[model samples]
Target chain A: MYKLICKDGNAKRGEFTTVHGKIQTPVFMNVGTAAAIKGAVSTMDLQEIGTQVELSNTYHLHVRPGDEVVKKLGGLHKFMVWDKPILTDSGGFQVFSLAGLRKIKEEGVYFNSHIDGKKIFMGPEESMRIQSNLASTIAMAFDECPPHPATREYMEDSVARTTRWLLRCKNEMNRLNTLEDTINKHQMLFGINQGGTYTDIRVEHAKRISELDLDGYALGGLAVGESHSEMYRIIEETVPYLPEAKPTYLMGVGTPANILEAVERGVDFFDCVYPARNGRHGHAYTNHGKMNLLNAKYELDDRPIEEGCGCPVCKNYSRGYIRHLLKAKEMLGLRFLVTHNLYFYNKMMEEIREAIENQNFASYKKKKLEGFAAEQGN
Target chain B: MYKLICKDGNAKRGEFTTVHGKIQTPVFMNVGTAAAIKGAVSTMDLQEIGTQVELSNTYHLHVRPGDEVVKKLGGLHKFMVWDKPILTDSGGFQVFSLAGLRKIKEEGVYFNSHIDGKKIFMGPEESMRIQSNLASTIAMAFDECPPHPATREYMEDSVARTTRWLLRCKNEMNRLNTLEDTINKHQMLFGINQGGTYTDIRVEHAKRISELDLDGYALGGLAVGESHSEMYRIIEETVPYLPEAKPTYLMGVGTPANILEAVERGVDFFDCVYPARNGRHGHAYTNHGKMNLLNAKYELDDRPIEEGCGCPVCKNYSRGYIRHLLKAKEMLGLRFLVTHNLYFYNKMMEEIREAIENQNFASYKKKKLEGFAAEQGN
Candidate 1:
């Protein structure tokens, strides 16, 4: 399913094939938590922006329009009208973060739904079943995401519990993928590595998860609240222990600069909500830095968001016009920036992949870092 | 210039040419009050949905971004990135309806901005100047829109003052169009007919304005709180007095059936915010009636809003999906419905024009009224 094509130092270029389509390496998955991107972006717009994959949250889908509802309507791919491959995150992250009164136990975590106060229980088996019903191309194994700044003992215990949970998730996914009623019989699973800034725990967790022979590997809980140097240290320490023949995904790790850094360290897949969320607030990502359209300096500035950016918004609309729309509370303001930001991210990935294939990724990374002066979003 | 193609009874099939583009007769102008459709529908989306002319509000533009800001950025058409013909409403309707602390006189009306409560005055010349800065294909003459229950004496005086304002507007627009830096040198002006509900006063006002040789004439303030019968009665009594060579616009007068009735009474142009505003609230205009998507029964209906509706939304998405988006408070829900409804209205006008050309408008109108059961909007 994963074929490595070339490598420029640690940056490897590969093509991952799924039933839906082939995704290029260094790909950014557009986040559509509820099957529709926030700020009114549609699947059609995603295709126009060169999105190779869509990442949706299992917690959100399971809450509002239940997983069964999506299954009845023919899964997330059909529901969203995107024929591209889809990746579904395990319900663990949102269940831990969003749900109130969450209780942790070996059987499952009992919690109240974030949308309503309805009590719900989700274990490894439950998350696997939901993802099976959602019928995405890639399903993440359910694991508890430990909070940041944990003691070494707590990190050790959490990693151990996550490993046992991964085993259960793997068994449940294998069984669910073969059931006659399963929407996607060939669904792939990728186990997440969690160790909260501990190199030994991360390496041990990565090695144990790689033994399952999953389709991909993901470094989760790194960008949760860790500093850049710590995240880089953990990734550099843990990646060597994993079976890197498979695709490596950096879950929820962000920013244009972050992507460049991760690609250099061999992270293949990424998804973040920054572009869409920041865009709704009138922040635009430009090559110079991040341009906030709400700033009064752009009131009469007729230039596009950037001089040579080829996104449709920048190609047709001026910074002044978009700024006015944002000031006036027009929805197009959100849409224009969202579309442009996504296009910028997607184009950035394409350039990164090209640089990797050409064996010049280091120079590309250096040039990009030199140009971007502003701090990327949290 | 207005070229009368043909007439089937009072429903005429004509074409009106402006410097920007030619608009087909019996056309519906999509209302983009702040240079944007309320539901985040973009100019690109409008083009795909068959929008002929975009009607923007001079008051909203002048208050929010300020018309001077738009001119500096490029003008309404370029700022909004719409290449089609645009018609701007004079800052008169909103001044009376939306502004506070308003005082009326022969020179102009002084009121506080609805947004910031900042003091601002607008007269014939001020309105013309703003419209010129917007550089729309057509501009409306400034006139008072009296309340619904005004006395006959009040109506007569208001009509007389409107005529005096019309002369001033004509003088100002003529001079503004010839200005060296004017974006639209050939900007056309449409004179408005307002006499409350008095048929005699309406006829006299319409006759007086038609003599100005304006590019078009509009019947304003009729739909401002009047009964459907009263508005229809006013259109029937007043349209005959307007010039045959000019396009007669029914400003803000609506409903699918209301439009048919006005077309039969010789009205040729229309603009209203109902389609977009209703769509934002999940009300869909179907051939049968207005269907609200927020109703819970559509949860798993798995059907399009209307069958045999040749809209992009209808062709690609299901009512069930759109309902899910709406229930989840997703903006795509409003966008899909807005695009679908506008396409529906534009398609309806096209069908209306075809029926007029075929000399079967009366039958078409009769059949349509029988089918639509719900009231359009308040």
Candidate 2:
């Protein structure tokens, strides 16, 4: 169960009560793609750095250690030592994006593993079962992530198939919750809405999923290589159709700037690998802009990555030292950058919630967008 | 001035009162090769994780940022945001190992920068002046780190040249400290004892440098490719010749097992890149033995890297998650390992100090080594 703690116009400040803990709304789930955040951020570090939720990939866990193995080891939370709420994405995205020789049918998809080329089958039921085995607080319904430039006919067919899969996911979740072996008996299932870049199709699909009355609704298939305006237009058109009472998650929608925009349009949850991934390339997100630590200009710049930022990296390390690490190709440099980026996103959400509570969200949104756009030099 | 606080057999506990802060002896200085720990550990993380002294390379910093630039930016402490003591290496080792077109003369060595083929000159005075520009608490004397398997004649000439360099280093350090333009007026100098695996030459060099009455004395040439037993034998033979009242630092003298052996042999200070370097490769030091996170067995292991490890990583992360991060080539994986390894070394030192205090040093060393050896077989 969750409660709407506060609201300001289209924006909401809420709390999601889970078995593990409660998560504040407009929260950013740090992406731990394979049950660990890339760049070595541990669950403890995540907690210290103010992460509310950890999002793990059902596909990666299912492939490497096997969901059954995780189940035997007492679920993903115990395996990763993350006592906070964890949301496990349905393996559908990876099946579409990472797997080889994928064959999609009405029931499910059969594909070869990207790691070992081993045959694997992932349907709605299989994804639900895997999430159940992992015992995550939130399990996403398996829905085909359609290609960005998909034909209208293909988009329509994919949405219908996704709706059917959502039903199977719901039924499987119900069965798993009743099973005594399940680690989280009260696990919540969030249904995903998928339609390729078409607002009419997206709104219709969102309306259909809203009727199912899932715990939450996610706007999927937008950030899959579409124009930012097109993605924002789809969200703006379709979000009103989703249940206003439930949390609206924008799956894999990104960046500090993107989150601010999405939150202004009323996205309550978000997850992205940008912070951890971009950190590996030596790019750190600062309030001014994304600073590349590899740039020679930072060689002797003794300033922190950002002033007035209280992250551990910013609080004690100078840009000069961080630049040195990046130049040396040290992993610590990446870790520091990723840690700062994640902290930046989480802190931005806090500020967003504060603005919402103060009834100044409009001003806050305008200011933040302007600040970010200024960094873009447009 | 440094003061010897306590002594139990050959194991001594002491404190070096520096301009920045007091440094506790039998201390391990965390190495920041390029002004940053190789893994994403920053100065703030270092402080939280119990680091007292940080070591930076003179060669790398001079090459990349340039010493003149660091001086312009208020020296390395302000540059790195570490207020505690910092020790800058003389660039002698890196110049010999990493630089190109090295030419050794009685005055100094001329070499090309490792990053660019630009010609550079570094003698004892230049090394001391660069460290003074960086304003590190302790500046290591510049000395030629002779290649292993050198003939007796070569080693003798190198040691003699190193002696001349030490005199120059001491005189330049004094001159820089008195200069009004110097960034660090209180900078201290530590003379290096280099004899390249020859104990008679090492003893003579140590005695000669001891008469210079420098702030500290360091045994520099032991770890550069000599067998462990041969290095241990040299320390056993030469340590008695070094002044008992002054602090004795062993440069780049290593692994947890190696450190324990050195501390027992009356070495009061140590620095090495092993913890951070080995960690990036997925190797972690545990009380048991070094555990490789890349091993398949760790994939489902839910325990911390060490059971009682109080570091942030061990407090909340599982071996399983760390293994997954390492397998994924994540920087966070390397950071966690490095953080844990540094914590392990520092904690071991604390334990060693405690044992010495309780007059149980002998038994503690024996038991710890036995346990470590037994775990290696597993």
Candidate 3:
């Protein structure tokens, strides 16, 4: 259940209650692909960094440790030892992006596994079944994530097929929840809206999925090579069509700036790999933009990654030591940066929610954007 | 100051007071090769894992961050945020083993660095200067680590030259300790005993270095391709010659069984890379021997890595989940295993110390060795 506490312009301050726990929107779900955060972070570390939700990739989990394997171990919560809400993406995006030699049909998509090159078929039912087995708090609908700049005709057919797949996904999820062996009997499904860059198709798809009354709604395929302006415009034009009572997730939607813009346009939930990925590359997110710790300028600087930052990394380590670790190719360097970046994202969301509730989101967003551009020009 | 608290046959229970803190006897110093524990462990994690002393490589630190850089940043303790006692090895071992195109002389060795192939020279004074800059609580004396199977003549010559280097190391450390700008003004030096596998030369070298009245003495160059019995014989012969009242360290010495044997032979300190190295390879150290998490049989095993183990990893994570993470090539898997393994070794040291204090080290060693061999025949 999502309760709209307040709003500042289009920015939303809401609370989402799930079986696991409550999530205060707009929440940035930490991406823990393959059941673990990429840079040696554990669920124990997540709590310390103020993480509310952990997001795992269904495609990766299904590929390596099968969903049945996770089910046998008592679902993802028990498997990862994370008790908070977990949002698992449908295998749709990875099936289109990562898998090789994929064939898309009306029933489903057939693709070779990225890991072992084994043939696998995943339709709405298969995707739903896999998610049901993993039993996350929120399962995304299996929809084709069309690439940006796709033709109107291709996107039209894809969105129609995705809508049909959403219906099948809802029905399958309902059946799985009613089953005796289901790990999470109350597993919720979030329908994703995909229309490439077409506003008409996006709005239409959003309206169409809105009527189906999913537990949540998501705007997908917007950040796939689309310009920032274009993504914002599409979000502004399409968000009004999504139900305000339901949680709105921006699937795979990006950086600190991108999240702030989405939140301004009423996005309530987000999951991205930018923090973890950039951190692995020694980039740290700060209020005043990103700091590349590998820079020689930090070789003798004893200050933390960000001065006055309250993150665990900032509280204990210095830029010089972390720089040396990166130069030495140590894993702790990546872990520290990743932990800090995720905290930066999650903490920004807390500020965003407070700003929205205080009816000062416009000023908060302006200052945050300006701050990101304040140091080293981002 | 080194205080011999008690003795159980050859096993001595003692405590060493350093500028940093007190280190209990039979302690296993966690090796953090490059100043940071590999496997993404930090100083905070070190404290949690019962790590009393941290061991770092002088060669690795000087090669990357440079000793001067650490000095400028307030030494290794502040640099790594570890307040516990740290033991730094001289550049001798790596200069012999890792460096390329090395030249050994009466003064020191000149070689190309393993990292960037840059020419470098390190003598006894240079090693002392580097450790003084690193400011570790305990610094090792520079000595040639002769390979196993060396002829008696070569072993005798190497041991003699090492003794001369030990004298030079002592004088330089004394000068560094008196210097006003030195990071660790009270840095203590531990002389290394090197005589290949020749017990006669080993005992002679141990007797010579023991007369130097250094803070501690380490049995180096053992466990370097020698048979277990041969290494044990060398330790048994040499340790008796070394001062029983001072702390005895076994450098680069190995496994749980190896530690037990060395402790039985009156070794008070040990350091090795097995736990961290094996962990990176998906191997976990347990009381019932080692468990390879990458094995197919652990795919669905939901039990902890070790039953009744109080380490953080085993407290919350299951073997099945850790196996999945390892198979997915996740760093958390390695971190988990490494943490548990270090805790296992450190916890075992605690047990060893208690057993020695209780005057039951013999029976304790028997039961522990039997327990280790009880499962998996490791």
Candidate 4:
């Protein structure tokens, strides 16, 4: 179900085939956490703006519509009307982040739903079952996302638990796939690597997960709170040990600059809420730099957000108009910014893939980073 | 420079030529009351979404940037970055609606600026001078928008004072146009008719303003607090008295159904904030009726706001996504709805013009009204 199409040094371009479609490797999955991109972007908007795989949260769907409800509605694709490859995070990150009262044991985590205080138990097997019900193209393996600044002893024990969780997730996923009632029999699993900022622990976790021979491997727990250099260091140390032929996913890794840096470090497949979040705050990423529409300087700026941006917002709207909307607390202002930012991220990834294919990833990375950082002084 | 292009019954089609551009008559001027569409739509969004002329407020601009500041920036068109013809409302309605401390007299209403509560005086000459400085394609003559249910005696005096204001406005506009310093060298004037709900007073005022030979005329003060039937009745009584060659504008007159009814009653121009305002509240206009994006039924609806809406929002987003945004308090959701609503209104006008041209307006009006009302029932 996965093929490596091209390789340049440590970087590789591949394709992951699913019922919806085949997604090109190094693809950026637009984060639609709850079957929709936050900030009012629609499925049609996503398609127009060049989104590939849409990543939904299994926990969110399970809590709201319930996986059974989505299953009844013909799974996530029909439920969201996005007939493109969709990868579902196995309720791990959200369950770790959102659940107010959680008890971790050898079996699983018992927690209360964030939506309501209903007690719920989510383990590796339950996570796999939910992903099967949703029928996603890719099902992320259940893993514990460790809290930042943990002790070395705590980090080691957590990695061991995550490894154990992976085995159960894999076994349950296989069992579900064989069931006739499962929504998707061909669902693929991507195992996640979890460790604190410790390089040795990260490599150890990566080595153990690789033994599972998952369809893809994800480097998680880095972007959580670590510095750019620290995150880069971990990826540099651990990626060479992971299977090079399989796609490397960077879970919840961010911004255009971050993505470019990660891609150069041989990481593919990313999802982040930054573009949509920053857009809602009236900031938009342009090739020139990020601009805040709420600033008074844009009040009468007749120019587009960026001179040559092809996004609908830039193609038709002036900075003055966007600023006005922002000032008035209008929703269109945020929607325009969010749409533009997502388009920018998606476009940036396309450029990165091209650079890697052409064997000039180094130059592309240098120019893109310089352009993004240059705006900081302003 | 205004031409009567076609006529079907009392309903007619015309074109008003302005220095900026020629404006198609019976056109619906999208209201951007304070140089921005109220629900946060920008000028660029307007152009792509089919806004022909943007209507700004002399009162709002004069209060915020001040007409002098806009003059420094170079007129309303340059300030707003919309090259299309723009029609600016005289500060009359705002002064009546917003001014905290106000006193109306023969010279002009004396009031405080709504924004800063600074003492400000606006007579016909002042209104003309401000509009001339702002350099809009067309400037509306200052007229007191009388309150509904006024006694016949009060209505008579108010209408008489409004006539005096119109003459002063015309004289001042002519003088300003000849001055080399004036931003708009040939600013056209559109005098307004105002006479509570008194039919006799309306006809008399319309006749007097018509004789002034202003470039266009407006039916104001209706739709303020009157029934739709009452507003239509007044239009029928007064429209015949106005010059047939010039365009007739209905200021702030209402819903999709209301516009259709008014067009059939011989009104030529219209402006309203309903589409944008309603859209911000999550209500969208569809052929089936108005769909509220905040409703729970849309929580899992993978369909667009409307199945075939050509607006960017509907073209690209699902109803479920829009609902999610609204629930999350995301501005993008509101912006999408506002953009879509404005597009719906502009498209309706285009269709209305086509129906008139094809001589099927009567049947078109019947069908549209039935559909809209039926949708509302559902």
Query: Which candidate leads the pack in DockQ?
Result: 3
List the candidate 1 regions with Cα displacement exceeding 4 Å.
A374-378, B374-378
Per-residue CA lDDT of model 2 for B231-264, tens digit only, reads: 8888888888888888899999898788888888
Which digits, one per residue and each the tens of the lDDT, describe model 1 over residues B27-94? Answer: 99999999988777888888898899999999999998999999987799988899989999998999
- The C-alpha stretches of model 3 lying farther than 4 A from their native spots are none
Q: Candidate 2 docking: what grade?
A: medium
**Higher-DockQ candidate of 1 and 4:** 1
Model 3 interface root-mean-square deviation: 0.6
Per-residue CA lDDT of model 1 for A251-363, tens digit only, reads 99799998998888888899999998889778998776888899988898888888788887888888888888899898888988999999999999999999998889999
Better of 1 and 3 by DockQ: 3
Question: In model 3 chain B, which range of ten residues has the least summed lDDT?
Answer: B369-378
TM-score (0 to 1) for chain A, all models? 0.97, 0.97, 0.98, 0.97
DockQ for each of the predicted structures, in order?
A: 0.76, 0.55, 0.92, 0.28
Ordering by DockQ? 3, 1, 2, 4
Per-residue lDDT, model 4, residue A123, is 94
Give the TM-score of each candidate.
0.98, 0.94, 0.99, 0.87
Superior candidate under lDDT, 2 versus 3: 3
Interface RMSD of each: 1.0, 2.5, 0.6, 4.1
**lDDT of candidate model 1 versus the reference:** 0.90
Query: How far off is residue B378 in model 2, in Å?
Result: 7.5
Regions of model 2 farther than 4 Å from truth: A5-9, A286-289, A292-300, A375-378, B375-378
lDDT of 2 by residue, A1-378 (tens): 768877788787888889999989989999988887877566777877889999999999898778887887789898888889999999888899999999998879999999999999899999999999989999999999998799999999999999999999999999999998888999999999888887888888998989998999999887888888888888888889998888899999897777877887778999999997788888887666777788878776777888889897888777877777777676667778888999999998889989998989889988877776565220
